[model samples]
Target: MAAEMTVSELVRRARDGQARALGRLISLVEDGSPRLAEVAAELAPHTGGAQVVGLTGPPGVGKSTSTSALVKALRASGRRVGVLAVDPSSPFSGGALLGDRVRMQEHATDDGVFIRSMATRGHLGGLAWSTPQALRVLDAAGFDIVLIETVGVGQSEVDVVSLADTTLVLLAPGMGDGIQAAKAGILEVADVFVVNKADREGADQTVRELKYMISLGRREKGPSWRTPIVRTVAARSEGVDELVQAVTDHRDWLIEHGELDARRVQRAENEIQAVVAARLRAEMGELRGGATLAGLAREIVDGRSDPYRAAEQLLADLRS
Candidate 1:
C-alpha cells in the first residue's frame, strides 16, 4: 500500500494528521522498505520534539493497563499521544500478537491517539528492530508524547533506555519484582518506578524495597535525580495523574540539568550505530552463501587454519 504513495507525499500527509498516511509511513519503516532512507530523510527535520517515554517491567505488571491510563491522561490535557506496544511475535504469523492492542481498545476511536503494536520478530532486546524508525514516524506526525511499552522486561530488555527520555519501570506487588529488578539491572535505567496494582497486598513492601535500592545506588557527582516511586492501581486508573506528574518532573529535571540534549545525542549515536550495523549485515549477505565464508569455516573446523586467519581471509575476499 505504501508503494502507491511517494515518500514525500506520505510524509506531508502524515504531518497533516492523516492517520492512514502515518500508518503507511510506519509500515514502510517496519517492513524495511527500500524507501525507508527517503522516509527518514523527510522525517529527520520534523523530529526531536515529542517526549519519548518507555514503560517496561516483567510480564503481568499491568504495563499495558498503565500505558492505557497514561494515554487517557495525556489526551485529557489535549496532547496527541502515540503508543508503540511491542509484542512477542506469533510463532506462525511472525506478526504482533495484538494483546496490547486488545487491551487498549478504549482509545481506538480517539483521534488524538495512535496505538500501534509491533512484533519483536525474535529481537532479543524486547523491541522490534524497527522501533527507533517507528518513533521517527510518530514524531514527524506531530505527536506531543510517545509511549513505548516494551514486550517485557528481562536481562536483555533494558535496551529501551537507549531510546526513551524517561524510562518508567513498572512492578507489581506479588510478582517478586524487586528481586527481578535487581537481577535485570533495571535499577540503573529506571527514571521513575511505578508500582502498579498498588491496591494489592505487599505493595508497600515493594515500594520500600525500591526506595532502599535507590538509596544504595551511587550517583554521579553532579546534579542528580533521586528516582521517585509512584503507586498506582492501573486497572482503575488510580494514581495515574501522580505518575504523569512524576514523568513531567523527570522531564523538567532533564531539561534543567541540560541532560535532555545529552541524552538525545546519545540516542542519535545509538540509532546511527544500528543503521551502520544493519547496512553491514546487508552487504555481508553475499558472503553468507559464497564459497569464501564456507571455505573459511571448513578450514577452521578441519584445523587447517586458525579462526582468526580464516576470518581475515574472509574479510580479504569480501573486500575484493
Candidate 2:
C-alpha cells in the first residue's frame, strides 16, 4: 500500500504510462481504501470534462467492433480515447477471457488510445465493482472520451445508466425472443440505440419495433430525450460516422438542458453510497468474524429464525 504516494506523483506516473500505478489507484478506489476518498476529492474537479459513453447489448451484437470504430473515428478527430471493456468472469474458473480486448487489437500500439479489460467480478449490477474507479483513473489521465463496453448480459446492464454520460444500447437484426426479453429495463435506459449488422434482413423491423417501444413508454417532459436507432455494420465500419454524430448530438443535448452536471452529481452520490455500503459490510464482517456469520446464515436457513428477525438480532448485537 503505497499510501504515502502524493496525488501529484501518482498522476505524473499515470501520465508517464505506468500501468501499475494506474491499476493501484483504481484498486484503492474500488476497495474503498481511506486514501481513495482523498484522491477522489482531489480529482473530482478534473472530471465532468471527459465524455463517458457506455455501450451495451446482447452477446454477438458486434459491440467491440463498433467500439473500435468509434475509437478510431474519435482519434482521427484528434481526441484521445480510453476504453474499458467489462467482461463477465467465468464462474467455473473465476477468470475473464477478455474477448473484447482481442477484438480491439487495431489500436494496441496507439498511445492516444488506452484500452483496459475489466472483469465484472461477480457483481450483480451488470457492472464491475472496479468500474467507477477505472473511469476516474481515465478522467485523471486526460482522456477526452472514455468508452465503457459492458458484459452484454441483458437487463442487469442498466447499471451503466447511472455511470455513463450517455448510454448506447446495441442490438442486432433477428434477435427475435432476445429483444422481448430485454425490452423492460434495457429499452428505457438507453439514450441512443444502435442496430448493428444493419445489412442483415429484418434490420428495419428491429429499428421500428424499438421506436414503437420507445414511443409507448414516452412521457412528456420526462427526460424528454429521443432515443434514435442508428444502423451500423460495425464489422465493415459502415454507419460509424452517423453513430458518432448521434452520440455527439445526445451529449450536446445533455449540455444544453443542464442535465450533464445534474447527472454527474447523481453519479457522485451513487458512488459515495456504494462505497459506504461496501465499507460497512466489510467492517461488520470483520467485527462478527466469518465463522459467526456462517453459523447465523446456517441457523436462518434451517428455520431456527426468520431472516429478517435474525438480521435485526444481529444488528442489535452489533450495537450492543
Candidate 3:
C-alpha cells in the first residue's frame, strides 16, 4: 500500500514526476472523494496553461494515426504533449486493446510525450470515469498540449467539447452516410473538421457535403468561424502542417474573441457536475449496501413496486 499523502504533498510529488503519487491522486478522484474538489481548486491555476484537443470519429477512421501525426508535428515545434486515448472495453473481459498507443510508436520513448490508454467502462460520455482526474494529473505535470481520443460509437460524443478547448471531428472518405447521420451532434461541437485518408478517392465529396451542412445552420458569425475542413493522409504524415495551422488558428481565434476563457469556465462547471453526480451515486450505493440494493432492484423488476416509489423509499432509508 502506498503511504497516505495529503492532497498538497500529493500535488507536489505529482508535479515532481512521482508516478505513484499521481496514480493515487487519480484514484482519489475516480472514487469521488471530496478531496478531488480540493485538489481541483488547488490545481485550477495550473490548468489553463495547457491546450486540450479532443479527437473523435467512427472506428477505423484513422483517428489514432491522425493523433500520432499531430503529436509528432507539435513535438517538432518543441511542445510537450500528453495523450489520453479512450478505448472501448470488452464486455467479457473488461479490458481494452489500446491499439492507439501501439500506433503512436514514434513517441513511445520520448519523455516529452506521455500517452495513457483509458477504458470507457460503459461511461455514458465518451470519456472514461477517470478522465477529469487524469487530465488534472497531466495539467499539474506541466504538459503544454493534451490530446484526447475517444472510441466513436456515434451517439453524441459531444461531451468532448465540454472537456477540450478545441474538438477535431475526424471523418474518412467513405463516411458520408455516417457523417449525415451524426451531422447535428458532430457539427455543433467540432471547432474544426479533419478528413483523414484524403489521398483516397471521394474525399473531396465528403468535404463538400460537410461544408454544405454547416452552411445550412443558422448562427451568429464572427470573424469567419466557419469550421474549415482540412484533408490529411495521416499514415504518411501528409498535410499535417496545414492541420496544425488550422488548429492553431482556431485557438488564436478563441483567445482573441475571449471565448477561450468562457469555454474553460464552462468546462470547469461541467467537471464539477460530473464529479458530484458520480459521488452522489457512489454514496447512495454504499448507503443502501451494494448487494442489498441489487436485491431491491430485482424486487422492483419482479413487479413488487414501481421503480420511482422504490427509489423514494430507498432514499428515505438512506436518510434515516
The best candidate by TM-score is 1
lDDT of each: 0.81, 0.75, 0.74
Model 2 spans with C-alpha error above 4 angstroms: 1-7, 16-20, 27-35, 89-104, 122-128, 154-156, 177-184, 219-223
Ranking by lDDT: 1, 2, 3
For candidate 3, write residues 1-320 as lDDT tens digits. 45466788888877776656766776566555667678777676766678889888777889888988998999999898888776554534544444543654666567678777666544323253578678877887788888988766544355654578888888889865745646545556677888899999989888887788788875343456878889899999998999899889989998999888988887778877876676567666776468656777888889997788878867786668
Best by lDDT: 1
Q: Which residue segments of model 3 deviate by more than 4 Å?
A: 1-10, 16-42, 89-105, 121-128, 154-156, 176-185, 218-224, 288-299, 302-304
Residue 198 lDDT, candidate 3, scale 0-100: 95
Off by over 4 Å in 1: 88-97, 100-104, 122-128, 219-222
Each model's TM-score, in the order given? 0.91, 0.87, 0.83
Compose the digit string of candidate 1's lDDT tens values, residues 1-320: 65687899999989888888988998878777788789999999999999999888877788878998999998998999999886543435645545644755687677888888777553222243588889999998899999988855454356655589998988888886566657766667788899999999999999999888877866341278888899999889899999999999999999999998999998888788788767655555567566666777788889899988977776676678
Q: Write the residue-wise lDDT of candidate 2 on 181-286 in tens digits.
A: 3654466667889999999998988888887777787633236677788999988889988988998998999999998888889888887777676655665566
Q: Worst ten-residue run, lDDT, model 2? A: 120-129
